[model samples]
Target chain A: MSTILIIEQVLNGLQFGVMLFLMAAGLTLIFGVMGLINLAHGSLYMVGAFAAAAVAGATGSFFLGLVAALAAAALAGAVIEMVVIRRLYAAPHLDQVLATFALILIFSEGTRWVFGSFPLFLDIPVGLAGPVTLPGGIEYPLYRLALIGIGLAVGLGLWALIERTRIGIQIRAGENDREMIAALGVDISKLYTLIFALGAALAGLAGALVGAIQSVQVGMGEPVLILAFVVIVIGGIGSIRGAFIGALLVGLTDTLGGVFLPELFKLFMETGAAQKSGSAIASMAIYILMGLVLVWRPTGLFGARG
Target chain B: MKRFLMAAAATALGASSAAADIKVGMITTLSGGGAGLGIDVRDGFMLAISQSGRDDIEVVIEDDQRKPDIAVQLSDKMIQSERVDVMTGIIWSNLAMAVVPAAVNQNVFYLSPNAGPSPLAGKGCHQNYFNVAWQNDNLHEAAGAHANGAGYSNTFILAPNYPAGTDALTGYKRFYEGELAGEVYTKLGQTDYAAELAQIRASGADSVFFFLPGGMGISFLKQYANSGIDLPVVGPAFSFDQGILQAVGDAALGVVNTSQWNKDIDNPTNAAFVESFQAEFGRLPSLYASQGFDTANLLISALEAADPSDADAFREALRAADFDSTRGDFAFGPNHHPVQTIYAREVIKEGDVFTNKIIGTALENHSDAYAADCKM
Candidate 1:
């Protein structure tokens, strides 16, 4: 590959990594603070995408649709937290998993009932519709570039929220010692709900942003959810910084692997066999990375707890 | 002893009366990501059955959830308990492979509305199996011919890494007379194409050929449109079908795709089917829907000649292939797979709706490559 091509692939990897970080950040925060295995988080992502598509179709404004996505997902997250998740905190992980798994089914069927089985249309904003010539004469999609900037900004914003704000301290403290925070006059339940909603909104934002490029349809979140879980595990559970780094690592590994693995194999094997074996291994590269990371550091790169 | 005699008599009477009724069990994906294709096939099949006004044709539909194991289980249930005389309404090739051979072996007529896997068309072909749809590779082969017609050389081709995916690339290369710039196999059910698109951009190919179906196609097309590579794209009709074209929006516009049937196929049955389907379902009929309609019609035509219980006579009737297909001049090859014309369609916008208009004939009177291998 040429230097220009490698640069372009790197940019693509960064874009994908940033997007994964959005989903992973929310999941890690929710798991870290609540200690509940929420399988329905992906459903919330789907909710955001569907809501954005609907509002955007109705209003013809991408910005308004994004706002709708955040509101709808947050509202859905808050309501779910109060009605279902509130009761699950004291429950075992298996019970939490089962309940949230049911939520995924309910949310999926409910969305299908409303939107029908066909995927919805959601395009990038007209201003970001085409590509831009970057430095070194590389032409890249402006929307993807914007996605990277937005993801990084969100990452910074989330970091500030967790580090600089009072709520951030309570969240961190709650992650450390929930009983102590509860005894210190903090309404842990309310904080849990707020954290869930905040995490949900981030997932929703990712959904809305990615939905513009990808098809906005039911079951869209499950794949991303799996990747996000991998991200948090690699970053260390409940660590936003870890999640960010892990997301980037997973993203870069996946993208670069898909492009280069086949070429690497081509050098040593027949063309057809190389493509087949290369792609077969590339699809598993992320899981291999995860396994290696766990072997090296079981808690993850940034995971504080065992 | 008296009660047992009476129950036996009642059972005999019920069996005699039920002999006239033809029970068809349809196991299709009605939920999950691939639901759209199955729904269209079901709707079209149901529409034809309803229009026939045959109350004796009892149709039992079940959702397979797009799982092969579930499909196998459903087929077993239909064959054993439901005692369905005819089985149909499978959408995916893998699911068809799981269900068709076994169902046909059980003496149940398996009329395929969609998904004609190559195995069933070749040495594994059964007398009771009939594929109303083109073989899985037919459209891809047509796409290859269309690419040649469009004068695209050094094409970059890609497909998901699976059995059917391998078949797609193999089919394309079988007919395409051009040098390939690159060949990549993407992960199945992959949503992102950023890496692949980057490769495409740098490949220096004059055109791109891909065979990703369903939402995978939508993602690829949208990402490709935005990537600004602007290379001409060609593919089978699965991606550009009526059910998916709306979601794909303007990104799909002006793209050439190949299919065996279109709404504008210039046949009386097709025109009426398209109109009534829109009237019934409030949307244009997809190619899957058309296949479903034709499948039902073929079954009805066979039923007119002989009862399904009479396997030999019914088989002969089906072999006659006398039916008004949505695609005109419909007939099965020796292997019971479709031998029909494949047309190249260009995606176009008519007002706000997205649909296909027939551009030209990609392959005339095309039959599958596997037909020669069929001993049956």
Candidate 2:
């Protein structure tokens, strides 16, 4: 209700939006370039966290763990692409979904088997663990602020990668005409592997960064993955720019909705009744936003028409 | 003709042996999000069975995959094909609600190791169902009492939007004789809590009580620490259990929770249990494991008190409160739930171990507040 509270909610929303963008950029890019609807993308995110945790625990250096996360995820992605995903490109979406879903099962079970059914701790490194004061006497986490920075930098880096590099051109070409790109003597398989690995690494980076603020456990990436999907879907599947905007929109909507809806409901109902109704409606707000977006622009805000 | 007669004789022997074997089926969230709690229950139950040396106890363990449909299917198979005499280990309430009714339909005793849904604690209670854990409402009630006793007025409550969360807030409100500043029902397994935390800070509640367990707990605690919301955070045992200890670590320090068991509880039985659990698991045992250990011990006591050769006899013995629990003196209530002490504890750093150390015992011989509401 207060201007200060509204500002704080918006900042909170932006931070969440940034995190979702980190997840969605890789996902949408992978989908756009590889033509793979990977259900196992979340598993790669898990891999990143596990890798980060293992390395960080071993090294006691969060920085090293982050690097390890990127390498591990990329390696895992490449290997999976070479062995499993390469075969699935020609397969139907259902088959791809099933195979990737199996990968999620295998990854989750395997992580549990290795880590032993318990969540691993990844800390916000010593200095970043504290809070930073914002405008209007509000305090925000230093690590989350760092994440917002990292997410923006990564987004910019991703945009540059796709728009400013030879590989980026090849990827865009592959997206536009895979057969044409292959006919032009480009090693499409290698390109696909590179894109997949890059996407995986990005996912892993997000996982490692987020894991510091959460638990690094099996299936940890799932809920975020769903949100990332929602982001990409709303942004237009394939558009990194759209992912950023869409993620922020969703983050703000979800965050502000949860807070304000209940207060709004309180105007007409008892406190408890207002909260129950408000929370229920707020929880659905993002999906509603997504639905409305779809109703208006079926392909998404930035999606290419077939 | 001789082969046929030999086959007939083996079939008769097999039938008799099958009748003698006590089939126990377990359905838990052995995979996905609920795996941490489910695995502890599974391990404790297995350890107890191993300790019992009861080779006749055949436990067919199945992962519910945290899906109700899968749980129903697995329970159905165990009931119809395996014909399990005693069934146990359902972690989630929905899974239990889905599977327990089916077990009750078959007249099989469903020993719930966790998740004592309120409905089962009341009107929907079946004679065949026994809950080893506290009624899902008991722990949160302790939290409410703790908050009230600690002078936390106008507290904001946050929980995942689910049956357990609903029950948890209800439990808190039952004991919390204070103005509720606000209550936010978040998405179950929400990774991000900054939005909610910001709102909580803005709402200016004196304290925030939450019921996020497992990974959600870790995220909430971490985010809360990050948000620098200096309010005293409180919740039930699962919010700061061993499963999330290392995950939350020092961030969880100063956070208060209420539970039925703490590893540091001074008791001979708990001492022995803790030592062995640490030795075996190489980590501290969670309350879920404690419930599982109690379930195992309770089952063993029932077996000892009953005619194991007769399934119906064993069920009656189990219902008759046959166990000396690890939680000192405890017994199953008429609705087949534990009426036990609930302790309020703070997450503390005990050298290398980051776990809850009991600071207060809120309810001594406290039955669930919801029990009176239940006619059954």
Candidate 3:
């Protein structure tokens, strides 16, 4: 491949990785602080996508649609947190998983009921509709480039929130000792809701951003949800930094493996054989990487031991 | 709610002991990922029956949830418990492969509206199974024919790594005599196409042909447009069907796709069907919808000819294919697959709606390649 092609693929990887980080950050944050496995996280992502698509189609404004997505998903997260998730907070992980899984069905069916089974259209804004030429005569989609920037900004912003702010300190403290914080007059339930809403907002933002290029439809979040789980698992269960790094690793591996594995295999094997085996391995590359990581560090790359 | 109504209608009908109530069981995906296609098929079939006001037919509709095992279970229940005389309305090829064999084996006539897998057209073909839609390979073969006629020498092909995908590529290769620049298979339901686009960009291919139905096609076409790839793209009509064309929108405009039916087909039956469907559903009918409408009318006409109780008469009536099809002049091949016209449709923006207009005929009186394999 040429340098320009490689650069383009790298950017694609970064763009994909950024979206994954948006999803993984929220999931990891929830699991870290609340210790509840949220299987419905993907449903929240779908909610954001549908909301954005609907608003955008109605108003013909991408930014307005995005804001709506953030608002809708946060509201949904907060509402569910208070109503259903709050009850599951004291329950076992299995119970939490089952409850969230049930939420997935409700959200999926409910979205279908509202939006119908067909996919909705969401166009890229006129300003970002086309490609921009990059350095070394490379061309890339401006919207995707914007995604990378947003991901980095969000990553830095999350770091500041967790490390440099008072709420961040309280959150960190809650993660360490919830009972101590509660005894110290910190409203743990409200804090949990805020955190859940914050995570939901991030996922919503991700969904809105990706929906421009992908069909905004039911079950859109499912594949992304599975990938986000893989990202968090590899990054460590509760670490944003780990999630960030892990997300990038996965995006790069998946993007590059899919592009190059077959080509690389072709150098040593016949055409048909290379294409078949290369894709088979490429599809399994991330899982294989996970297995190797688990063998080395059971908790994950940055996971802490209980 | 629809199922409840159907059940209630059947119960009220059962009280009459009319014996003319030809129990028609339709098992299709009504929920989950591919629900849109199945919903269209169901609506179109029901529309035809409802428009005719035929109380002699009792249609039982069930959702398969797009699972093979569930489809198999529903097939057994519909065949044994419901004791349905005829069964139809499966959308996916795999589900058809799973349920068609057992349903037909039990002597239940299976009328396919959407999926027409090649196996069912070949040695596995049954006298009781009739495919109203084009065989899975027909549209792809038409696509290949279109590409060859357009004079594309180096083409890149991509499809999901499944049986239908394999059939799609094989069908294209069967007609198109060209040098393949590259071939690739992607994961089913994969939304990302960045890697594949990159390969398409680098492969020195002059054109691209792909078969990714539903959301997969939308994702690929949208990404391909965004990536600034300027290759000529063609594929079967599934990706360009009415349900998803709006999502693909401007990216799909000007792209050619092959189909067995289009709204613009010049026929009285098609004109009436389209007008009535639009009035009933407040949306233009898709190819799947047309197939469903035709399948329902076919069954209705057969019912008019002979009762479902007479196996030989009913099979012969269905094989005659005397009903007016939306595609016009449609007949069944020896293997019971549709021998009909395949049209090339170009995605065009009609006002604000994204829909297809007929460009040209790709195949006329086309019969599936595997029909000769059937001994019966």
Candidate 4:
């Protein structure tokens, strides 16, 4: 591959990774603070995508639709946290998995009930549509480049909030010791809801943005959700910093693996067989990476004991 | 009111007429990723059966959920319990391969509404099985023909890595005289194609052919349109069909696709079916729907000639092909798959809706390449 091609692939990987980070950040945060594994995180992402598509279709305003996505997802998350999640805090992991799995079904069917079986279209805003030529005569989509920038900005913003703010301290404290914080003046329940809503809103934002490029339909979020789980696990669960790095790593591995594996295989095998085997291995590249990472550090790359 | 009339007819025919009942058990994907296509097929099949007003035709429908194992189980249940004489309405080829072989072994007349996998067209062909749709390879071959006719020299071809995907590319290559710029098989259900699109843009190919069905096609087309790569794209009708066309929107406009039928096919039966389908379903019928409707009609026509209980006579009647098809001229080949015309369709805006209109014929009186291999 040429330097320009490699650079483009890297950009594609980064764009994918950044989107994964948006998902992983919330999931890790929820896991870290609430100590509850929420499998319905992907459902929140779906809610956002549907909300964006529906609102944008109605108003023809993409910004307002994005706002609606965030609001809808956050409100839904807050409601779900208060009702079902609060009851499940002390429940076992199996119960959490089952309940959240049930939520996934409810959300999928509920969305299908509202939108029917057809996929909804979400157009890229006219201004952001099309590609921009980079240096070295390389062309890249403007929206994707913009997503990378947005992801970085969000990452930085999240770091600032977590490290430099009062709420960040309380969140960190809560993560460190929920019982100790509860003994102090902190209203642990309200904080948990806020944190859950925050994580949910981030997922919604990712969904709304990605929906513009992909088909907005039921079960869209599940694949991304699985990838995000991979991201968090690899980055070290409950670490925002780990999520950031892990998302990029998985993203790069997936994108570059998909592009390069077949070419790599072609060197040793016949062309058609090479392409087939290369793609087969490439699909499993991320999972293989995760396995290696876990073998090396069971807690993840940045994970530490509580 | 319709229920009352059906009830009245049922009583007149006698409730004890189970022996004469031409029970058709349809197992199709009804609740998963490509559920929309299966739903359309089911509706179209039901429309034909309901229109025939045959009280003796009792249909039992089961949801396959797009699972091959589930399809096998449902087929077993339908054959053993429902005792369906004529069975139809399977959409996926994998599901058909699983269910057709086992079900047909027990003397069930398997009339395929869709999913004409290649093995069945050749050495794996069964006397009890008949494909009402065009063989799976026909549409892609027609696409290759269209690409050749359009004077494309080097084409980048892509499909998912599965039996159908392999068949699609092979079929394209059989007819396509152009130099292959690249051939790639992506993971099935892969929604993102930016990496693939980047390769296509760089490959310097003059044309592109892909065969991703349902949501995969939607995502690919949307991503490709924005990639700013202006290469002319051609493919089979899986992506261009009515169910997902609205989701694709203007991104799919001006693209060419190949199919055996279109709503605009110049036939009276085609015209009548299109109008009634829209009237009943409040949506345009897809190629899948057309296949389902044709399959149902074919079954009905065979029933007119012989009872399905008499397997040999019914099979002969089906081979006679007495039914009028939505596509003007259709008949079963020696292998019992369709030997019919495949048309080239161009996606165009019909007022507000995005759908295809037939631009020209790709292949006339086409039979599959595998017919000679079939011993049957």
Going through the candidates in order, state the TM-score of chain A alone for each one.
Answer: 0.99, 0.97, 0.98, 0.99
Candidate 3, what DockQ? 0.72
List pairs with backbone clashes in candidate 3: none
User: Candidate 2, which CAPRI tier?
Assistant: medium
Candidate 1 per-residue lDDT over residues A1-306, each given as its tens digit = 999889998898899999999999989999999898889989889999999999999999999999999999999999999999999999999999999999999999999999999999998899999899998999999999999999999999999999999999999999999999999999988999999999899899999999999989889999999999999999999999999999999999999999999999999999888999999999999999999999999999999989
Proportion of true inter-chain contacts also present in candidate 1? 0.74
Off by over 4 Å in 3: B1-20
Q: Estimate each model's TM-score.
A: 0.97, 0.95, 0.97, 0.96
**Which candidate should be chosen as best, given lDDT against the real structure?**
1
The residue-by-residue lDDT of candidate 3 on B154-180, one tens digit each, is 999999878898899989999899999
* lDDT measured at residue A194 in model 3 versus the true structure, 0 to 100: 98
In candidate 2, how many Å is residue B107 off? 1.0
Candidate 1 docks at the CAPRI level of: medium
Cα lDDT computed for each candidate against the true fold: 0.93, 0.86, 0.91, 0.91
After TM-score superposition, the amount by which residue A293's alpha carbon in candidate 4 deviates from its true location, in angstroms, is: 0.8
lDDT per residue as tens, model 3, A1-306: 887788889888988999999999999999998888999999889989899999999999999999999999999999999999999988999999999999999999999999999999988888987788888887788888898999999999999999999999988888788899999999999999999999998998999899889888888888999999999889889889989999999999988888789889999999766877788788888888778877888888999844
List iRMS for all predictions. 0.7, 1.4, 1.2, 1.0
Model 4 in CAPRI terms: which quality?
A: medium
Give the higher-DockQ candidate: 2 or 4. 2
Order of models, best DockQ first: 1, 2, 3, 4
